[model samples]
Target chain A: MSAVAKTLDVKGLNCPLPIVKTAQAIKELAAGDLLEILATDPGAVPDFNAWTKSTGNELVEQSEEAGVYRFVVKKKG
Target chain B: MDDSQGTLSLVLFSGTDDKLSSASILTAGAAALGRKVNLFLQYWALENFQKDRIAKDHGVSKDAEPEGASLMRLMREQGSTQHWADTFRQAKEIGDVHLYACALSMEMFGITKDDLDPLIDGVWGVASFMLEADGPVVFI
Candidate 1:
């Protein structure tokens, strides 16, 4: 597993906010850095997928446990 | 990264909290995906942008009467929902989002640019808004 440069906890935020904050947080990371996001919104699953694809970032890992959705995205090099 | 997803133009005609919140969410989502978002505030929507009224309660739309209105109020009281203005601010911070007041509406309300909250970029005529719309405009 690649090292995560940052972990964004957006557990309580609703739709758009989780993705919005992720977009803002990922901007501060260097290329190739990994951003692990923890979100409670079920929408995050599909939101992250579309976000990564549209923004050209790599969704290196994704999983859900006990209703919490986790995603590890690597900034495009 | 493809920041060229094109512009999403929105016409905000309703001033209700629920409507504004919905529009704000759409703006933020579009912005997060690297799309430019242009919001044209008109009629009641433009009136709500006044600096003194922006933070006040604008209430829910008529469609959300009775139980639905109370649910929204409860969420807001619980601090579970973000204010629409703040959402728009964050959207602008992270992407190409611009808010403009309709010039005709401004004249109707007798409000100058300074009367509005700083969140609004400027006052624009219908022609100017259409020129930048670039695609189908969504009215809220």
Candidate 2:
């Protein structure tokens, strides 16, 4: 299946920004697309889960490399 | 999900000051479900509703401490009042949460409107806040 990809740079943004921006980005994308979020804020873990659950989106991958935190979310139809 | 599930208004009355996770959880839950949410910030919590003061450094994980420190020595060791306005500010930025400062609480604390944070949508007395509370309200 072909999927679209989008990236949101949310570094320096605190707890809700990363989540809020991620939700907004997913809202603009089509289903089956990937939303990659880069955030330095450590609060993104639980925050993203809460966001995905609330919005019916799918969080496919989450990891931290060096000091940068990254998450991949799939948009809901 | 029912888009029109009426509305929920949360009235937070406490001296807990800036720890907003409790309030955030309620507001976020409502917002997530696309429900109308109103959060009234009273007492010291109103200090968190300001825009300029909010952006200031409030340290980290300070809000983790709940009301009435079970272990005083432990709390002091853990650093009481670390002040995390960032998290609170984040909750405000997320859409669908309505924040207000309690007028009675403000007067009790001798806080003028200028003393309050600008992010506060409006200031209201108990009567105004209570009207919404009757519909569907949760006290945090």
Identify the runs in model 1 with alpha carbons over 4 angstroms from their true place.
Answer: B1-3
Residue pairs clashing in model 2 are B50-B117, B58-B83
Ten residues in sequence with the least summed lDDT for candidate 2 chain B = B79-88
Q: What does the i-RMS of model 2 come to?
A: 6.4
lDDT of 1 at A6: 98
lDDT of 1 by residue, A33-66 (tens): 9999999988889999998888889999999999
Candidate 1, residue B36: Cα displacement in angstroms equals 0.5
* Model 1 clashes, total count: 0
iRMSD for every model: 1.0, 6.4
In model 2, which runs have C-alpha deviations exceeding 4 angstroms? Answer: A7-21, A27-33, A36-77, B17-19, B47-84
Second chain TM-score for model 2: 0.63
lDDT of 2 by residue, B1-140 (tens): 33456567887654343345446655654555456677787765665455545545332234545443444334434542223343344445545656778888877767777766655678888777777764867776
Clashing pairs in 1: none
